[model samples]
Target: MTAADFQIDDREGGSVLRLTGDWTTTGLGSGARDLQARLGEGRVTALDVSELGRFDTAGALTLVQATTEALPKDAWASRPEAGRIYAMVETLERQSAPPPRRPDALTRTFAKIGRGVFDIGHEMLLSMAFLGRLTTATGGALRRPGSIRWPAWFSQGERAGLDAMPIVAVTNFFIGAVIAFLGANLLTQFGAGVFTVQLVAVATLRELAVLITAILLAGRSASSFAAEIGSMRMNQEVDAMQVMGVNPFQALVIPRLAAMIIMLPLLTFIGMLAGFLGGMLVTWSQLSYGPSFFIQRISEDPMMGTHLMVGMVKAPVFAVVIAAIGCRQGMSVAGDVESLGRRVTAAVVQAIFAIILLDAVFALIFLELNL
Candidate 1:
């Protein structure tokens, strides 16, 4: 077969592209580039394929792409196969072409912001809906105590709370120690280093213990719930349960929710004690305050019990938010690995965010009430 070539003639009407030689794979080497370059020099108003030889799909594609104008009908009269190939390749190229250019940068940024706001609103609505469903399910279980899954509740409690005790205890211990160190360092300058006892006691009992424990559960238990339920979703097990006249919310969600509600407060109590011990040890080692003196100082603090009660009050709320976010994200997962992963991540993030926001709201309400 001859090498592909094209000749451009300056005709009276306009330029004419006359394709020649073999346009098959091996024959079309430089011809594609030469044809494109010639076409770029000036627009060809007419196409001539009369003398084209040894044509194939490759040759047709080259000819179709070399000029902007459509192939003349008469040019393909002598070569109907070439015409068919050209038509096919031309249609495919048109279908595969890139989309129109994107909006300008400012417009894109505004669009992104708009989408983000919409997503946040949508997510809030979904969460509220989930909470309503959870409340309804809980009411149903309360009406018929036999529907409550005690075994599942115990199992989830063991996993979410009992297994998490060590990390929560250790983390809060260090947090309390750090608070003691900072308080002593600052108060010593004002001849008030002894007040460090009150600082650690109030901080740990009122905020640190509960907040830290909730954050830990948000990361650990929330992720676990999302992944477990998301896997169930991906496998269509949740669907099967519905078909079998089962309520997934009762079997799967309520137990976890009950577990979190019961276990988080217990964990927070443990964290508060651990934190007090840690602070006591730090004060004994860093300052000259003995364990007896530390204990005495904390015991004498009038607001200590109030602080403890306040912290305890926040746990159930935090528990509900964390468990609800996790279960909701799990239920939202599509039948895919990517959706499962995304939902798991979103569970942790949304739980943490809700925990912090709720904590801030609690702080405001307590402040207003002079608590």
Candidate 2:
């Protein structure tokens, strides 16, 4: 068969190659090689194929191969036909290439941990800035208490506090029971069974109650805060609030921060109570410790009150951490559902890390204080 007739038309600022009639394999290959030479020499910046083109896959592959071999770097190919051909060739090449080597498990885990630490640090810095803004807004509101948005506060409290109680209660109860059981078993072996009461009280009131409650709040309340604020951000509701002469931080963030601040301590208190009860049940049934005996042990323990106070203090700080981290991440969320999910996850993770770190600091302080 005769080769297809074609012509190369050079245009100002670019080059256009027009083809007419059928393109034989020989003609297509030769054309591709010639185009490749021109492209390699930087003589052609753009290729145009708007006229008289009838080409098969072979013809298309010729142009793709030419471009792939000629292009000095990954530059944009503007011609539709060339782009399409390039994409096809790329897909085929990728499929034909060997599978990528997998990283070692330890290496992957450390990489993930490094990323998590970086994310937490970034989130904490942003959270500190958000907290500063919140402090300013709170002081302003205090100057005019009526300026505080009570309705928003109540709504957020209902969502973040009341809605989260069941899970928090269950988790705290189980944690308390587990700690009590473990402590009783170990202490009983050493003939220190009576001290189990003190152990349960100190562990639950000073550490487990605060730690478990903070974790639950981080996962539930903090994530919820991030998601809610992120959704508002994604929907441009935050921007709309600004346009309506309302501060987005005041209207969107203040209420959440307030709700969490007020609610988390209450939640922690409730969790402590539930956990104590769970421990009491274990003590009575498993350890033969009566209610009076347990009560006496707690009252006689010199550090019991101090432990309780420490846990309560930690609750408020943990609440602030969760709320601040959540709101900061939400405010930073981009306008997409995926970003919302990611920020929410990041908020919870960061809040947990902060809570644990803060708890450790408190533990060290109390230890030094002989409490």
Candidate 3:
């Protein structure tokens, strides 16, 4: 009916606050604090709000605080709504509440680092467990070689090794040629250009061939394996196989692993042959020596056997690591398109990193043994 306003009436026991107009917080005027301070200066007895127009929490609190510690019960019983709120406000103990505080930047930074480390450890543990399962499955299949699934093995071998031949051939050939050219250029100044043949042969056989092949498979075979197995997981086909008393490892994982184990060494040999030819081409063009002389130099090297053995031995190990990571990531996939994509990417990254790490370890071991 009217704009919010109120007045204080001084009384014997305390004060009788009389309200009129709209007594909401918004319209209580700039004098709201002054009125509250004056009301709280001494004792207050009761609030007479019979003439009140509009009332809200702000006005209710103002009326209640104006009253003394021993506010009369009869004063509040008159208006049920405002009285209930004012009574509730009176019981609050402001001193008991504490303010909220935020964590500092350093604390948050350390927390994030701790979480990241924990996630890495957790993932490594999961991958290791999967590797264990695959190892056991491989042994179990060995007892009955028929479980190895020769068709899948042949298919995967063709897919990973044969199908990948063109890229590996072209790339490694150029790499070998580049190495030879660079070596020939450096050695020509000293009349030692022929040594470039031995350099290309030993380095390509001992490191570059297998290393490049493994990296390629990490990207190619790993992503393909993850995608194929992840599709089965997403479609619930893996579950279906389990229900039918079929071991997915025997049917899927073993064949892929077997294929990789057989194929990688053969691929490495092919890469080495192709890379040698490239180096031979470069050496012949630069040093006026044909492939016969290049082959003779490489053949005369005493360490050639050691280099070939070292490189060939690493292939199967790298193959298993890549295939295991790929299969693990695939089987871990959740039944969603996004999860399948994520797992596939993870498979490639994990496989490549593991291969590089394993290769480095092998290098150190061989160096220590003087191989």
Candidate 4:
């Protein structure tokens, strides 16, 4: 390869660089070092690479290494050609690597178990810390309830309740229909078709409604809480609050948690009603069961109230879990968009897991009580 000819000149805001002919390793290195030196002196902000040149990997590597090393870590590079340099490096790194060794089945199983235990421990510790902080802040707020921010509570309520109603309504309606259809099909075979009404009512009021509502709140409200708080963290708003002598947990977390705790029960109730109505439609229209007969069957079932009560009780607990997980994950977020994304995802996953675990606990308690 022939040596490249290049020219550097002062521009209106930064340096202008032009290249001509073929770029040899030495020529490329010289040009890259010069640019690096200019950047070190804080004199260069842009480069003009539009001039004619025939370059190989050495030339590309020189540009890539210089750009990567010279610029401030946060500085943006908008060069299209420079992308090729990074891509080539990445491709080479991947292609030159050996295939990963697969673990034996027992090793993989043990690794998974170990990871699960670690994750559970980490989550528990974080949750305990968050709850401790929340309790401290809440006690302080209770001492001066008038000092508690009302606007924040209203905003959170609106977001967690009104904004989430439509989707919750649609989903619960479909879920009710599905349950009724499945029960009707199975029970009809046993000449117990009339029991479908009790099945739909008890299950919808006690389990499906609350569970579905909790999951929706986890996905929608919890994720939103995490993302909002994470953004505040990234923007240093939480630090600013601290500097201003504001309690972030009281101002942020309490309001959100309170809103969720209050609204979730109400939403679950609404979901239960919608689900029951959907089941009623299927039973009365498709199954030819009269509305009176459905209502009578539900009322006559002694265990119906037990299921309803179980579901209703689960709602508040689920809300608490969802809010706590979201707030904890959000507070843990580092100052980056990527960290925010990860924490938001974690919030949803953790909230759902916690909800399911709590439901299981409730189920065991109810079983023990013979309810």
lDDT of each: 0.91, 0.78, 0.84, 0.81
Q: Provide the clashing-pair count of each candidate structure.
A: 0, 0, 4, 0
Model 3 misplaced stretches (Cα beyond 4 Å) = 1-103
RMSD of 4: 13.2
Looking at model 3, the pairs that clash are: 3-22, 4-22, 15-44, 15-45
* Candidate 1 residue lDDT tens string, 94-205: 6786988989999999999999999999988988898888889899999999878899999999999999999999999999999999998999999999999999999999
The Cα error of candidate 1 at residue 330, in Å, is 1.1
Clashing pairs in 1: none
What C-alpha RMSD separates each model from the true structure?
A: 3.0, 10.0, 7.2, 13.2
C-alpha TM-score for every candidate: 0.88, 0.71, 0.73, 0.71
For candidate 1, the lDDT comes to: 0.91
- lDDT for model 4 comes to 0.81
What order do candidates take by TM-score, descending? Answer: 1, 3, 4, 2
lDDT, candidate 3, equals 0.84
Q: In model 2, which range of ten residues has the least summed lDDT?
A: 69-78
Model 2 stretches with alpha carbons more than 4 Å out: 1-54, 57-125
Q: Which stretches of candidate 1 lie over 4 Å from their true place?
A: 1-31, 41-59, 74-79, 91-101
Evaluation by TM-score, superior candidate among 3 and 4: 3
Count of clashes in candidate 4:
0
lDDT for 329 (candidate 2): 87
